[model samples]
Target: MGFILLALGLVLIAEGLVYALAPSLVEHLLEMLRALSEAQRRNAGLAALALGLILVWLAFRFGV
Candidate 1:
């Protein structure tokens, strides 16, 4: 539970930094995402989910 909270906090910080440093880029990215079809968005989401899971698994596996 602690780890989950820490991860969530870190994610928020990272997202905040992106918006602060490049608000226009974030807006452009959002527009591009909106332009994507439902299927495309689903595939992209699934890919990100798989990548995030693999990253966490590797981090624990390697004691990183």
Candidate 2:
């Protein structure tokens, strides 16, 4: 759907900006993530997924 495509594009733009503005920070973050255990990574990913869903839900709910 259009909304899904728009969301994907926005995510790409945000990710691009982070890499563009702070390449070293991004590399450091990646290194830290690589050092995390599988379970820790999975939990972190789940937390991010839940947070993103909540944000999107609120955005649509509030017509923001």
Candidate 1 local lDDT, 1-64, one digit each (tens): 9989988998999999999999999999999999999999999999999999999999999996
Clashing pairs in 2: none
RMSD of each: 0.8, 0.8
Instruction: Candidate 2: list runs displaced more than 4 Å.
Output: none
Tens-digit lDDT track of model 2 for 1-64? 9998999999999999999999999999999999999999999999999999999999999996
Q: Let me know the TM-score candidate 2 reaches against the reference structure.
A: 0.95
lDDT of 2 at 31: 100
Clashes of each: 0, 0
